[model samples]
Target chain A: MEEVKAKMPRYYLAWAKDDAIRKKGANGGFVTATLVSALETDFIDVALVVKKKSVYEGIPVLTNDPEEIKECSGSLHCVPLNLTKYVVEYAAKKRIGLPTKPCDARGIIEQAKRRQVSLENVYMVGLNCGATLHPLRMREIAAYYGLDPDSVVREEIKEGKIFLVSDEEGKEKEKWMKIDELEEKGYGRRDACKSCVTKIPTMADLACGNWGSNDEKKTFVEVLTDKGETLFKNAVDSGYVAIEEAPGKGIETRQRIDAGMQKRAASWKEKMDALKALSRSERFEFYVGALKNCIHCGACKEVCPVCACEEDAKCTGLYDERDSYAISMYNLVRIFHLMDSCIHCGQCEDVCPVDIPLTLIQRRFSERMQRHLGYTPGMDVTKKPPLYETELGWSAEAE
Target chain B: MAEEEWEPKILAFCCNWCSYAGADAAGLERRQVPPTIRVIRVMCSGRIDPAFVLMGLLEGADAVLVTGCHIGDCHYVNANYKTRNRYEFLKEFVDELGLEPERLWLSWISASEGSLFAEMVREVTEKIKKIGPSPLRREWKK
Candidate 1:
């Protein structure tokens, strides 16, 4: 145990000291406690937390008050908002601490690379995620389970089962269903979450979750960087949290879980790619057919996490409504620009008004290009995107 | 009109420092170059943005050529290398978009290589003719 604690990147089982917070939080209250402690100590100027309006809704709230942070405890699995743009627009200059999922952390990292946000001012507490359900889908799921969607007050996922609790006429009822069985019936996670392989937020400062912890009231925490160590020390010294070294068996279990999730995600990706069977001309027809429905709303660009260009973007600037080409210049330029840097977050598809399946189209174009260049965006701050590289740094023969 | 009599309209972007002067030399030498190509001269090959090429294809050009100085011979001290780097991205994009690979061409020509300029135009014209008109072309209503 001492040897494990002595390592640079340490692992531990941690929980909150306060019983109220522990009871309210989904996994222990370690994340909530740490953020509260950081704010109380003035370590961060503000903390960005997801405030749950209900089981189906969460809004990003930026605050310095520790009381508000405590109130925002617990997890909301149906909220799929990416908080990168909010950080850039609202708290880019402040010392901000926030709990991040893998996609949110990756988006922030990519923004840092583009000079949109300073990495030094941001502290991330990462959460391990298997998947998130769309809010509408969750409602449909409630209906399918023979419960009034509005009556459902609580939801929990554990042991490969989805548990829903409903209140009616001063009585409580509970029901559970297997996630695999639900997904097979065409109703589980969002399309993006089903294929995403990054189940753990390894790119963030500290990663916290319940994957490896033996107790339901404790969180398995991994201090991934120097900043993570600082956050952990502050939480422990402030007396808001308690910790114990993670058992070796717990570490093995965590690794096994991550590997299993990644394997399942890869298989899902293969199954979801419908364009793989099409010929060149048919693929062209499919793209034109899908993209023609775009109303030029630009919602996808607004929600895109990797795109740093705010106004006066080339895609919109060069596109003219009069052209009426087979494929609009807007879609063409946007796809071309993101070839090297797209993180495939699926935020675009979520916001697209026409339901054009932008996620599948962007993935088809960008994934092959990224693989050819041997580049993965948002992974590192120093490795510049290959698209911006000069010929001297990037050889033409590399193709 | 017969298929053999159909002429493909080609758009060629020539850099002022090298390829543009090479085209001038071809005219001076009275070389038998194809009249199918329409020349658009820019200050440097690096100035030719990928957007320009994409716009050309969307505008119904049967083929587009990107002509620049040879490697290490760029008049702007490696700007043409940037053009080469961008060309790779354009190549992959065009191919994936279901366009024939033959529709796009990239070549290096010096000011003295007038014969090379004429030969490239003839070869490009021949290939475009064989492939027929691009599907992106907009036919005017009678």
Candidate 2:
């Protein structure tokens, strides 16, 4: 079998019989072919995929054209964009398909719980994501290694190594660094990515990844929902992809890989929880110290994937700049609102101009609250989060 | 330091059908309520958004009281259930923000429970006094 470039259709752990697509895509171009097939067959009216501008940059493009979908094949490890709000804002009523990282899939499901978007019309092809690089950090890593950051053509992080592959026309330079060494040097995946445990997007319709497969050119796809099955059959019937049954060992391998990634992330989470070492007043001081630098721009709230608030949100509406509170009403109300529904996606921290460690802060506040309530946001829409829950599921006296 | 003694400034939000009428009843019965509390009346306890409690804290109120009719006795029927739900969030949030848990409270005071309202105010004022001025308070000397 040669590189399978998108051409014809077939169904788990299968590669495109066409060599052109299989060679170009990270795995088997199954995701690209599926989206293309979905569009061509009118299964979905639109497909949203990130178009990579560079190793450090990608932008989400909403398109209905199969050729456009085919062109945006390979993934960019540095573009940590969440597509949940985009769907709510742009395609709430349309039949839509999009590739998702775990956070993106979780964010979308959170929006669905809030009734911002209807999950019935959305098809999520969840990509197995170990982690993503911060764009600025990637540039820094490139420059730190004596390479022009702009000249870098491809960046791959695999097996704990950061590989910088630079191609200027026909001239190519490839270098690799241990992720642990880079992290020691304060460069690598974003803190949220380091701490994130959602390696497999079980919340999505179909979970696709290279985790379990021994074949380097094929993808291991798990049909998680009925919608996933519909999508798989649609792509196969439309002749845009061909898949084979995954080998038995592949499933066990995937589980082992997931467990390993989770353990690593758990350690990172433990390491990053700064409040654990602080006294009660010191903890308060630490939070106030970090949050006081806020110019109250509301950028964090704006980019929050799970936040469904608009211009007149509770956070902004009651906040007075002149208030001399130890903490601003904006941060207070925002944190309060997120208590039950924060999916811990880290978009708020990503977009914060002041560089507040919001992922840590949000996780600190929400983790305890969610643990107490026995509620996990974004997993099941039927389970209303504790904030909105009318009856206290647990006794109030339990506190 | 000015050597002037500090007093707790409590901000209480009372629902109109129950707690607000109860506060009025307290006045009618000449109950000795603490002068520390400044009562704000709303038609329903559910009408008090969490922002209001946070705003009170930010406004230098040592304690913010959220009082409504008893659960299942809401004028709107089941609205106080929502209030209780929100109070749970407010309680966790206040604690997490590093404020003394005593600085925030939730209680049910019926329209006829004037003395209970007065007693609750006294209790809140005494507890807040023990905790000292709210850290969020802007010192007059400052």
Candidate 3:
């Protein structure tokens, strides 16, 4: 485990062997097929999937049936649910499999570190992500372009553009808008996704996406860990999937795309930071102005994926609504607790009733502290968070 | 027409075995201690959670001081090491919250270090005085 294998990363051009699933699933149905196969073979007792309800909405479904897994094919870019808590609360004891975005996988790993869930019983199939759109923003974009939001049939983000296909009178019309252009008008991806640098779920057992695939029907996959290998080997053995060694060009292309996305994310981090231009006193005013509107609703804490403290949360217990400080004890305690483990999932901002730009606020406090500790949270389970360590693991403390 | 001069309220969290005794020692030695400080004593520095510091700030304390036994000298084994670890988080947090970096402090003061305790208090008072009132402070006149 210590030695980084020069060729240890196993790459494959993977596709669902079943014709029906391949047609229904975007790219290949490898994730769906793998989950189905795992369940069929009793490799996992259950699977968690976000069953799409509409183009802009989906509901998380926990099931042990292979048929249900097949129906849950395709990705929902706007379904920003974190599957970690679902696994912890519902499937913590059972061997289970689930597809995950980078942030979801990161949250799960963090939960494992906190002993909230046992990783041995969980199998994560990671997807390479380019940011997800906020559902409310989708409606705004629909209205801006003069289309009925409910009539939209399919939405896909590809080649720096968002494609919304609408069905009217048995005919489909498509409209394309560049993500950058939409974001400039304040109507694209969420602020958290824009600033996020970890686009690939490296912490997951296996990572899969369409970035480097030469064929539109195939997925490029990298098996990251032993559990990932078990899932891959099971699917191939069960004849549920087909795999070929990924071409060198495909691997190079994947790296190139990932690097370009990270570069864009860096600029977005600068552009979207509300605190960047403010003077220290101005920054003070900004926080007070934003956080004071809080009605003491615990929605932000409730939606936080990395937070393991549920009913007995210290933030809620210590909070008194009457304490009329510049910032509330609720906000203060929550921010402090999340300083080390916030994955910047943006769920808190999405759920806030007062619409506090909490994505930016939490990021402002956490980014500096994480960098100073030279520690990145949610990447590995064996390494404890620096906040919990007795002495920080700094290379040159004197320096 | 002068209202009472606004004095900085500094909240100091002292560990019972060490820094609290150090404060008592300061009194016994007749060292000049600042009246601005209000000390809250805990059993050990390890018991001081990051929430406590944030709570102090939210309550309108101009500054909060985290005082503990020196690194290797925890009354409970290896607890002050935990305190030092958490101090790193509080330092960054106070700075990022747009508070002056001088608003939060961590110093290791043993029971014997009466003079150092007195000096740290004086230094904190002067720094807070320059920074003026905490923005969180409520003013009924306003």
Candidate 4:
């Protein structure tokens, strides 16, 4: 904490694997204390993240998990866990704060250039992310394994398998398991992570990891940018964070991890290709099946980022108790409404109780949109969709 | 080949400023263009939405033609540019959807080119008549 204060005293976000923090049990009291320290100052305001639906159609606020703050005004927003909310919040607030995650940093950079989110106020604190699983799915998998879903430690992700540690009698036994390995045992993940391309977090000011050492005891935080370099240097000189060059075992361990990831990537390509081969009609049937399993929870649409409706009245009765056909027709229109805007983030699939491959359906359509229109959603904010605007002989390059 | 009926339902979406005027001029001059052509005059060729064009085919139009002003001479500036790129995009889209891309067409016409307008109508009408109504729509009936 002293080290962090001796430095720039800027908003800092840190990402560390659970085990690294668990060695001291209270995460050496760093993460919570950092939040507390930031809250104490009027200059720094911290926002904790909670993801819900666009049903309310406003800033990302989470009503579920409430936290106590000393001085910082913390509000949750019902936005996706991706960098879109971070960027939007930063643009709206016009203040300096730290964001953690590699893709979040990349998303911010891409959005910032389009004036969607400005990076001028962002302090990019990147964590080397192999992937973020849909949290509820993690809980489900843990339950299937007969482990306390909440207690199972998700240690590391390498390619096709996740490495987890479970404690029995104060001793830890590590288990390496694939998603399919889990599925065969009766649990599956949301579809979006199946096609994820980035293994290491990208373009972050600093990158931290848990996979770098055989000892696997320490958080491997690397400064990848000038801002990160300065902050770490200050933090270290002031004793806020302990700093060290990774041991040789750390490098060796990470190499094996990288090789494992490469092997997984090859197999992932085959699985994703098969997933993509499902016809549009077949995918639509999947949606129908999902809706049939509906308790009318309305959670899927609620979490959907581009589903522009607020209340049940706004939703046009897709799920009336008596009218099943109306629901099917309503689902079709909803699919079209978000057909162009969906990023295939799989957040909706995660939120669905029926375990519908909602993300896969979106992926199928988004793939078609790209094939048909050469438009990849979320890549560029400037490209006006061919469907939305009047047809004129406009330059593909809008200059 | 002649045993199969060549009844072309050619949908010509013409811009009001130029192509529509050209079609009117062709009619006034009594040019011998095929009567199979159905001319729908829009505010601008550029004003035609791709969904409308796609829906026209889905509704069983044998051929769809989008006619607008020549480059740099749009009724509204750069409307033709949108028309061109959008048509090209739809062409690709049709190909990907396994529909015949040739069934869709784009051409440039002016208010004064009565002869040219007659020739375009005659040629497109002939091609569509030979190709017949979309098999995709025929399959949809079952």
Candidate 5:
């Protein structure tokens, strides 16, 4: 126990001490308990959590009440909202705690690098994620399973299968389908989630999930940073959570799961990219054709996690409605600006009103530039974006 | 009338400290510079945002030349280095957008290099002439 405490990043199996929280949360409510404990102890001024509205929806809630944090415990697999912007806009100055998926954690880190949020004041309790389904896709899936989409009370993903529970006249019915089988039918996870390789949120303060825990009542938690250790210790000392050292076997199993998910994601990325076969001119036409439908509503820019420029952004400021160019300057400038910094979160695609395939367009442009520069955005905060770097610091060979 | 001989419209961004002076020097000397180029002089090359280049391309400039002071010669001290960095980004952007590599050119011209400035304009004109016309150009009906 002393040796485990001595290490900076320690692994443990933890559960909520409160029976209600233990029963309410997935994987023993370790995250909920920690946030509650932190809020009660004044360690953090606010807790940001996703309040589940339904099996298909969740809304981000920022509260200082410990009970509110307890009420917002469980996971929602279908609601793919990113909480980074909320944290920046609402809780940037306050000491805040929130549950984060890999993309959320990465986005927050990128925002912090851009000086939109202060990292010292934010504590991220990261959840391990395989992928998230679009809410519309979930409804389609529910109908495909012959269940009423509105009647579905609970949804869960476990062991490569998605389980949906529905209640009719107080009688419960359950159905499940394998994720791979459903994906073959062109409906499973969002394109961004399917291609994302960050299965574990190592960039966050702490990473907690159920992949390593054999027991369904406990969470496998890895203390990744000093802030994570403080949060864990506070929860334990305050009698909100109970912890036990994780076994070596559990750790190995978690690593295996992460590796498997990453391998699948890489293959999915290659398979989903339809532009690979097109010649340069064809690719150009494809980009112009896809982006021409943009109404310039600015929804994509509003939800873009990596974009911190807000109202004064050059993309919108310089764009002219009068220019009848093949592609609008708005899109061209945005693509150029995000070439180094795009996290490929697909939020832009999700919010696009014209049904533009921004995920593919952004991925095609930014991914190659990122690969060429050998810089991955949102992974490290100390490394400034390459676009902002000087020639002496970053010299690319002229072609 | 038969279609007039196609001439490329090349837009050049010259810096005030060195490249703009070099353009003036090219006129002072007897060296003949191509009539195909139109120059926009800025305080410094670093001020040339990549967006401006994109705008020039979309506005039907067959080629955009970014001419600046050589490295370590910027009056603002290391500002031209930023131009070099941004030029790299512009290079990748133009290529990915299906523009020919010759459509974008970056060169450093000192205030005294009148012959070099004239030579660059001649070379850029020849390249743009070879490429014909930019696809971004929109033809208006008479």
Candidate 6:
């Protein structure tokens, strides 16, 4: 560990175990403490879909129910367990703080390259996601077990099964619960997360979790970037956490991540195949159907990193005094406006309530972008897009 | 907007010293060609941006035709390279948006190629007419 710390300081660091538990929403009191820390620090401006009770002393905090992140169609301001926009925006504006997950880090990188945010002063905290449960379904499952949704303790998911800790802290935790138990109890997840890829937050600077932990008290934290390393080292030095060499624990966590990724990839392949089989006209119909149910919530657009529209307050282009334009022209314009800039982060899909399958539509367009212009957004900040330049080899008057 | 629409609306963004001169020669020859085309002359084809092509399409033009100096013959040494690459890349980009790639055309008509200029316009006009109007043209917010 010392050798690694000395040699790869630029890309690696160590995280104390406690930081990992807080990432998982493990202890409500601990989570509240961390959330308070996140709130008080002006270093990172946080736009969270948080309960009013979660409010803190200082920070620019945008409040909404965290569950709102699921039904959003246009953009994602928070949720997806990553909180990328908050991390990146705050980092660029203020500097130094943690984003939620790996995917959030990717979103931050994409936004930064577009000059939407700066990456220099951000801490990308990664949570080891087994699978993101559909929020409503999770609530319903809690109800089925005679547990109030608000009273639900830590909900741990592993090996495709869900274990809900509904008892009070002094009560013995419930044993492992099966996905079938939730189903038999009449609860299902949001469709988006059920088909989501990326369980380990691959873009995070520092990923931590307890996916492989036998005890809920200990967490596995692995530093994947210099920024993460610096913060973790500081935390250790400041006596905020206890550090040690947990090589075996680290390997176990990594193996679980690998396994989870394989599962996610398989599911993604199935969803993509289903999407590909749809005709172009049918695909258009799908988007139209999705748009019809839109409540002008602006949740989707709000969460979008590509959505830099300042006029969102008025809902000018996407929403107007008249109903959001009936499907055709408005949607086309909106899609194109985002086409060149969208990073396909899937936040919009994750947030949409109507289950619009936004990621599917964006992926379809991204595929076309790759095939034609040979351009892929969010690949690198330095390389200019092919569309920004002119065609090569052909003369202006070759006819 | 007709299927057999011959209103070429050809946007010839040509370089001043080269393709623009060649365009002048085509007119001076008294060639009986369709006047449906609108030519915008500039100092160099290299000055054009892909955004201009997008703007032209959005503005109801049937086709955007760019003409520049042939390779090794640019007025601003290697200026033609920028034009060549820019248009080629944009051509693919337009196609990806489900737009008719044929609607956006690129060619090299040097100052010496007066006859080529006339022939190119006639050919591009016919091709664009066959393709008809751009979908974005229909959606244009009058």
Q: Give the number of the best model, judged by DockQ.
A: 5
| Between candidates 4 and 6, the lDDT winner | 6
Q: For residues A109-158, could you state the per-residue lDDT of candidate 3 as single tens digits?
A: 89899898899999999999998888888988977887788789899889
How should the candidates be ordered by TM-score, best one leading?
5, 3, 1, 2, 6, 4
Instruction: List ranges where model 3 is wrong by over 4 Å.
Output: A1-9, A394-399, B1-3
The model with the greatest lDDT is 5
lDDT of 6 by residue, A131-176 (tens): 4454556666767666666656555566657667665556644645
Residue B36 lDDT, candidate 3, scale 0-100: 99
TM-score of chain B of each: 0.96, 0.95, 0.95, 0.88, 0.97, 0.89
- Candidate order by decreasing lDDT: 5, 1, 3, 2, 6, 4
Total clashing pairs in model 4? 22
DockQ list for all candidates: 0.52, 0.54, 0.60, 0.19, 0.61, 0.22
lDDT for A44 in candidate 2 is 97
Interface RMSD of 1: 2.8
Better structure of 2 and 3 per DockQ: 3
Q: Of the candidates numbered 5 and 6, which has the greater TM-score value?
A: 5
TM-score of predicted model 6? 0.67
Please list the C-alpha lDDT of all candidates, in the order they appear.
0.89, 0.86, 0.88, 0.55, 0.91, 0.56
Q: Please, what are the lDDT tens digits per residue for candidate 4 over residues A171-246?
A: 6666667866875554554346556544455466665555573333345555565655654554444444544556
Q: lDDT of model 5 at residue A264? A: 95
Top TM-score prediction, candidate number: 5
Per-residue lDDT tens digits for candidate 2, residues B20-126, read: 99999999999999999999999999999988888888878899999999877899988888888888888888898888999888999999999999999999999
TM-score of 4: 0.63
TM-score of 3: 0.96
Backbone clash total for model 6 is 40
- lDDT for A334 in candidate 6 is 47
Best-to-worst ranking by DockQ: 5, 3, 2, 1, 6, 4
lDDT of 5 by residue, A124-228 (tens): 999999889999999899999988888899999999999999897788889989999999999899999999999999999899999899889899999988788
Q: Which is the winner by TM-score between candidate 3 and candidate 5?
A: 5
Tell me how candidate 6 scores on lDDT. Answer: 0.56
